[model samples]
Target: MTEQRVAIVTGAAQGIGAAIARELAADGHKVVVADLNLEGASAVAQEIDGVAKLLDISDEAAVARVVGEVVDEFGRIDILVNNAGLVPFTPWEKLDFAEWKRVFDVNVNGLYLMTKSAGDVMAQGGYGRIVNIASNTFVAGTPNCAHYVATKGAYIGFTRALAGEIGKHGITINAVAPGIIASEGVLSGPHADGFDYVVPMQAFARRGVPSDIGPAVAFLASEKASWITGQTLVVDGGHTRN
Candidate 1:
């Protein structure tokens, strides 16, 4: 039997976030779908008897408020999936500084702010699980994504450092770095071409779907992973084996 838990999953409007929300709900946790796209978030929440909150994770005030509301509604926040990220992959010569800033703003900074705010709440309650979504691109150092790689690398660093700092607080911080997930973003983002050659696995051969990443997240967010922290669970179907 699974104990009741309340999970807040950002970027839950679609793709991996939606899959994780459904998996968690199936595991018996009340879910709150938080995303910048309010309509999409609400729709997903409605499907699973979850709640939706409009959020721009990049904004500190918005992140704090959303976390507060979840804590207030659920009384305790047991899991947080920091799955929102911006990936703008272009050559360095053509990349815009503002675009790079936006990528970092959401991927690294937003993640830090959410973890900080949620960590405080979970610390007060004495237990919590945080799963941050990074990417295998950082490990392989794939070319043409200087901005994306930097932010995700920062996320990996944040996972390690925060795990050490908050381990004593009874909270665990970990990360999952997926490669070539067949999501809307992956199919349409700047990485579509790159995924074909750089991924080392054909999209039609054995590329990952959102479902492939969901259970790993659920496990990490569950008590089963209590002993694991400061780790990066790579879910790239054996890609980046070098």
Candidate 2:
């Protein structure tokens, strides 16, 4: 029988993060829905019979506290999904230093802090899976979103380097880069018009959804991917054929 694992998915209040949380739960793993939106996280937790943790991943103190609490309650964390991030659409000329910092705070620094804290615990346990959420824009390169793409590129680099360092402890770290997913946030945000432009470009000729990403994340978190590490699985329905 396969042992039930404990997972922590950040930014799980909605969108891709929420879908990953549900997918992991359906796989029979005890999931922790961590998000800044406490109510949303709690609701998802109830739906999946998992735990809800209010977290601001950019804050080092908050990240440490959540890791400690989860470890104390669950004994060990087997999966850590760094899915929490910010996506801002602004032209490069208008993208100020403050805006760039804010984006990196959640996308880059947040992932680093979470990985450092959780990876330490996983190293001690001698088994762990770290899956980071990146974007396909880093490969194809998009206009008006340089900061977001740079952060994802940083994630890929970090995953490769960290995997080499932590593989000795049986911890595998990888990344998933999704195309323009039509999640609730994108549908109502300024990027709605982007779908029309993106769909025609995709080889699949369909808009990507949140569910499309869940299974991929689940696979990376599974024992079946034991030998896979420091890789980026692009799930964009062949949008960016890299």
* Poorly placed runs, candidate 1 (over 4 Å): 198-204
Cα lDDT tens digits, model 1, 40-115, are 9999999999999999988999988988888777789989999987767688898898888878888888888888
In candidate 2, residue 51 scores what lDDT?
98
Overall local distance difference test of candidate 2: 0.94
- Tell me the number of clashing residue pairs for each predicted model: 0, 0
Question: Each model's RMSD to truth, in Å?
Answer: 1.7, 0.8
> Model 2, residue 111: what's the lDDT?
93
Highest TM-score against the true fold, candidate: 2
Query: What is the per-residue lDDT of model 2 for residues 92-138, given as tens digits with 9 covering 90 to 100?
Result: 99999999999999999999899999999999999999999999999
Runs off by more than 4 Å, candidate 2: none
Model 2, total clashes: 0
The collision pairs in model 1 are none
Which 10 consecutive residues of model 2 have the lowest summed lDDT?
184-193
